[model samples]
Target chain A: DAGITQSPRHKVTETGTPVTLRCHQTENHRYMYWYRQDPGHGLRLIHYSYGVKDTDKGEVSDGYSVSRSKTEDFLLTLESATSSQTSVYFCAISDFGSGGPYEQYFGPGTRLTVT
Target chain B: SQQGEEDPQALSIQEGENATMNCSYKTSINNLQWYRQNSGRGLVHLILIRSNEREKHSGRLRVTLDTSKKSSSLLITASRAADTASYFCATSGEQFYFGTGTSLTVIP
Candidate 1:
C-alpha cells in the first residue's frame, strides 16, 4: 500500500452532470497521476501533477480536467459527464528517483457509470 | 501513442501450469514494468525490468527484457488460481504508457 486513497469508489451519474473524483496520498510523493481503464484501451493517463499547483494534460484529456492545490490531493473533474466517460479510474503516486527505475503505487480505483 | 502492445489478449491455463505473456513497445524506454489487477481492483506492481537488463526473477515470477527487439516477456511458474488477473505492461520514458493487457485465468 502506498498510503493512497480515492473517494467515491463507485459512482453513477447522469450524462450531463458534473462529477469529481479525489485522490489523496499520505506518502507525500512528488508525482500523482489519474488514469482510466476500459476494455481494449487498457489504462490511459488523463492527467498528472508534479507538484502542488503544477499539473499537465495527458493523452486522453479531452473530456477531463484536473487540479492539485495541495501536495497530498489530486482531483479529476468532468465538467459535464458523458456516457463515453464511463470507466474505472485509478490514481497512482511515485517519488522522484535518480538514475534508475521509478515504480508507481496505485489506489483501489473508482468505478464510474454515466447513464 | 507510446503504449506497448501485449500478445494474446486472454489466456486460460490449469493450475500448476506456467503462463507467459509478451509485450512489445515502439519507443526507447528507461524501464518496463508489469502490473496485475484483479477484477474491479487497482493494479499491483509485479516486477520491473530495466532496459539494460536481460532478465530478472522475483519468487515465482520471471521477467525478460529484450531492448534490441523492443519487447519483453513475463513468466509465472506453477501458476495458481490466485494468479488469475489482468496483467499489463507499462513502459517509462518522458511518461508511462500501458499496453492493452492480457487477461489470464488460472483454473484450479
Candidate 2:
C-alpha cells in the first residue's frame, strides 16, 4: 500500500545530538503515530497526531516530541538522542472515522543508532 | 507498556504443519488484531477479531479471540517457508498495545 513512508531508512547519531525522523502518508488519514521497537520489547508508541498541528504523547515520550504541520506529515524529533534511543522507528496511519476497527497500517521503519 | 503478551516466545515447524501461538491481555478491549513482521521491518496487518466475535479466517490464517479469558490464539494451517516471521497480537483499549511477538520459523 502507498499509505505511509518514513525518511532516513538508517541513521547514526551521537548522544546529546538532535535527531528528527519524518513520516509521510499519502492516504491523508486523520490519525498518525510513531513507535520504537527494541529487543525484548514490542513496539511502543512515542506520539500520535490526530490532525494538523495537533499531537499527543504516548507511553515512551520522555525525550521525544512530535509535530504535525500538515495532514500528510508527522515528524518525530529527539531533543537529545541517547544510547537508549537506538532502535527501529515505525510510522503508522489510521482512520478514526472509519468506524470499522482499530486497523493501523505501518511504514517500512527507520533504523536509528545513537552512540 | 503493551497490554497483551504472547506465549511460546518462539516456534518452529515443518512446512505444511500447523503452528499455533497464544496471546494474553490484561484488560478489556474492543478488538484484537494479528500482525506479521519480517526480521527488522514494519508489521503487516493479518486479521482482526472484534470482542463480540469468536473466530475469523483468511486464507491459511485462523485467529480466535476469547474475551472471557482475555486471550487470543492464531493458528496457521499448512505453514510455508514464506510464513517465517514474527507474529504479534495487539489489543485496542484507549490505545493499541502490541505483544512482544512470537517468532515462527518454517522449514521447507
Candidate 3:
C-alpha cells in the first residue's frame, strides 16, 4: 500500500449525510491526491494537495471538498453524500522530483456506499 | 473530462502467451503512465514513458509512446495468471487523467 492508509475501509451511509474520509501517508511525499473509481468512469480525481494548506480542485470536485492541514494527512469531506457519489475512493502519493517521472503510489482504498 | 481512452476493453489470453493493450489521448502530455489493478483494489504503477522518450522496458513489460499520434502501447511478454488484472493509462500535464482501463485475463 506504499505507506499510505485510508481510514474506514468500508462504509455504508445514507444519502444527505456528511462523510469524511482520511488519507494518511508516512512517505511524506510532496503530492497527495484523492480519486474515486466507478464501473464505467474508471478513476476521477477529486482533489489534490501540493503541500500543507495548498489544495486545488480536480475534474470531479463538485460536492466534495479537501483539506491538508498537515504534511502527512489529507482529508476528503462530502458535505452531503448522494447516491451518485457512492464509489470506491483511493488515496495516492507522489514525490514529483526532477530525478524522474512522478509515479504515484496508492492506498488500499475505501469503499463508500450511499443509499 | 478523461484525457485517455483504451481499446479492447477486455482481453483473454493463455499463460506463456503475450498481451498487448493500446491507449490514446486527446491532448499533448508531459508523460504517460501505466497502472495495474487486481480485482477492485488500489492501483499499482507499472511503467512511465516520457514524451521525449519512445519506449521503455521493465522486467517483462514494455511500453512505447508516440507523441505525434498521441498514443501509447503496453506489451507484456510471457504472460502469467498473476498478471490478470485491469490496466489503465494516465496522462500527466497540469494533472493526471486516467482512462477507462482494459481488463486482461491470463488463463493458466
Candidate 4:
C-alpha cells in the first residue's frame, strides 16, 4: 500500500454530464498515472503527471482532461460523459522518473457508469 | 501504444496445473513486468524480469525475458483456484504499456 486513494469508488452519471474523478496520494511520488480498463481491452493509459502542473496525454486520451494542482492530488475531468466511457478507472503512483524506478502502486480504482 | 500482444486470449486449466502466457513486444525494453487484476479491482504487481535477466522466480511465479525474441513468458506452477483472474504482461519503455492480457480459469 502506497497510501493511494481514489474518490467515489463507484458512480453512475447521465450522458452529456460532466464527471470528475480524483486521486490522492500520501507518498508524494513524482509520477502519477490514470488508466481505464474495459473488458477485452486491458488497461489503457488516459493521462499521467510527472510532477505538479506537469502532465501528458496518454494513448486513449481524447475526451478527457487532467489537472495536478498538488503532489498529493490529481484530478481527471470528463467534459461530457458518454456511454462508451463506462469503465473502471485506476490511479497509480511511482517514483519512476527521478532516477532508479520500479513498479507502480495502484489505487483501489473507480467504476464509472455512463447511462 | 506499444501494447504487447498476449497469446491465447483465454485459458482454462484444472487446479494444480501449470498455466503459461506469452507476451510479445515491439520496442527494446529495460524490463518486463507481470500484473494480476482480480475482477473489478486494480492491478497488482507480480514479478519483473530485466533485460539482462533470462529468468526470475518469486515463489511459484516464473518469468522469462528474451530480448532476442522480444518476447516473454509467465509460468504459474501448481495454480490454485484463487489464481483464476486476468494476467497481463507489461513492458516498460517510454512508459509502462500493458498487453492484451490472458484470462486464466483454474477449475477445481
Model 1 / residue B33 / CA error / Å: 0.3
User: To one decimal place, how large is model 4's interface RMSD in Å?
Assistant: 1.9
Superposition error at B77 for model 2 (Å): 0.2
Q: Assess candidate 3 and give its lDDT.
A: 0.93
Q: Give the lowest summed-lDDT range of ten residues in model 1 chain A.
A: A94-103
Q: Where does model 2 exceed 4 Å of error?
A: A97-100
- TM-score for every candidate vs. truth? 0.97, 0.96, 0.97, 0.95
Task: Please give, for residues B1-108, the per-residue lDDT of candidate 3 as tens digits.
Answer: 655998789999999999999999998888999999999689999999988899999999999999999999999999999999999999987578999999999999
lDDT of 1 by residue, A15-48 (tens): 9999999999999888999999989999999998
* Model 4 agreement with the true structure over B1-108: per-residue lDDT tens digits: 689989889999999999999999998887888999887778899997878899999999999989999999999999999999999998875467898799999999
Off by over 4 Å in 4: A97-100
- At residue B48, candidate 1 shows an lDDT of 85
**Residue A75 miss distance in model 1 (angstroms):** 0.3
Which residue pairs clash in candidate 4?
none
lDDT for position B1 in model 2: 56
DockQ of each: 0.73, 0.65, 0.67, 0.58
Candidate 3 per-residue lDDT, tens place, A1-115, comes to 6899999999999999999999999998989999999998889999999999999999899999999999999999999999999999999998775634498999999999999
Q: lDDT scores for all predictions?
A: 0.93, 0.90, 0.93, 0.90
At residue A83, what lDDT does model 2 achieve? 98
What is residue A6's positional error in candidate 1, in angstroms? 0.5
**Residue A20: error of model 2 in Å?**
0.6
